[model samples]
Target: MLVPLYNHTVETPAAFFLVGIPGLQSSYLWLAISLSAMYTIALLGNTLIVTVIYLDSTLQEPMYCFLCVLAAVDLVMASSVVPKMVSIFSSGHSSISFNACFTQMYFVHTTTAVETGLLLAMAFDRYVAICKPLHYQRILTPQVMLGMIVAIVSRAFISMTPLSWMLTHLPFCGSNVVLHSYCEHMAVAKLACADSMPSSLYSLIASSIIVGSDVAFIAASYNLILKAVFGLSSKNARWKALSTCGSHVGVMALFYLPGLVSIYIAWLGQDMVPLHIQVLLADMYLIIPPTLNPIIYGLRTKQIRERIWGLLTCCLLDHFSQNS
Candidate 1:
């Protein structure tokens, strides 16, 4: 039994749900319509985040600054998932050409990796503001922030490039079907006929390079944050600092938990993720964070709440004046 199990190869793979649709329970109709709505909301939601932070000079600080970077990462990640989903649902076929699949895989991983690093950056930003206020300006200057980001992004691109290249070299002689939706490294790697041990090792390395480094940095940042927040002289200042970092904390948890789960299910669990569930979770990372992050942050921030109220009041006044 062990021998057969060890020697077995997966031949036929098919995802249960159609892509780019909403309401996963039923047929493609609802899923397509739902995903369409999600994409629209993700686009508008993250765009508003970027625009609000950009348009308002008051929000140009390090906290909101990191948010702008988050919004950008969300946009890239959303673009990778939403369009392909729409294509599959609208067309009734999940047919991604080889090049397109790899391209999508590359960017999807890139944004996620970028987000992981960016979250650490934000955490460090908070630690500085609370822990070392004296050196905050010197530590997180415009040139410094920009330079750090450039280095992180370039590093992510360089590190993940080998995984994609390694994957491209692998031969897919058997099932072209990717078990779960999208060309996930694990999902696609399962199809490779050659020795994907290197690819698998690379996957472990990639996970460590991205998640491991980010987690370590984030842990260090938060440790300093806890120490600093506890030392705050003012009660209100402590609360304010905590509130500023809350959305980031939430975003980090949401992004990382599922990611850790996915890596487990893909490499260790080995096809245990029911196709439908995997699709839902796959899209959740893309759809949920982008839509919810702004709302969470806006509701939490006094400035954002006041701005939203003011915008609504202006719209109502405009409508009444026009009609009257």
Candidate 2:
């Protein structure tokens, strides 16, 4: 486990990561444990999605290709933040170095931006598939998919880089206790010993750019997709369209709604909740989406369901063959 590199005096977690305040009890530990379990499930879930997609030759279409990217982003997003959370909860020490905290903040939000872009791409892919099936191949070719990934990653980092730099430039004269599981933007900004007005402004702008723009594109793409899908007069065509859009819609709602809520909380100065509750709810940002996303895809997509069972069967047979 990676331990904190810097200390404020002694090495005990204060305020955010651990429930180590004067009156807190064992229930907090249980909550952390539950979150750890959730992270494990997220890891497995995203891994399974990646594995199935990579292994199945038939899943080489743009939809699954975008889903593979989504799964990979979820994998990183969950992994980048979770181990630190587990460590802080288990050891009751949440001290992180300035550089390390900035790095964490960058990667977590970077993955988030990547996720938003991929979701938009997915919405666009669905539009092509349903609205212009004949042109789908030309529209979303492999080279085009690669360009999309590069663009998503590049644009995300470009938009958020200033916010990452803002963390380092701010002076932390005294306060070091972050008010959440990991080094999130709001928590880290609140920890600044100096006034965080500049950092706060930068974060707001970056969020509006990366998160805000991605969401706008996603909503717009889906709006057009809705019109096209509904234009299909046949019931069977309607069902197919519904089925195709269901997973993307569910995943988008799962990710963005809570994220928007968190922005609200951060804006409201965490809204008078105990730091513990805030931390728990904040931790939900990492937990819920990754675990549920694969399940959402599996439930909505016949190919994914079949692929999962096929993988399960392959694993069982491999185990039996190895044993025999």
Q: After superposition, how far is residue 104 of candidate 1 from its true place, in Å?
A: 0.5
Off by over 4 Å in 2: 1-26, 243-247, 271-281
Cα RMSD, model 1:
6.7
Candidate whose TM-score is highest: 2
lDDT of candidates 1 onward, in order: 0.72, 0.74
Q: What does candidate 1's lDDT look like per residue over 142-228, in tens digits?
A: 888888789779977988888887887766666676655566777777777778889878877788767987898898888788778
Per-residue lDDT over 224-283 for candidate 2, one digit per residue giving the tens place of the 0 to 100 score: 888887888898987877776776687677788767667656767755656565555556
Error of 1 at 158 (Å): 0.5
List TM-score per model, in order. 0.80, 0.85
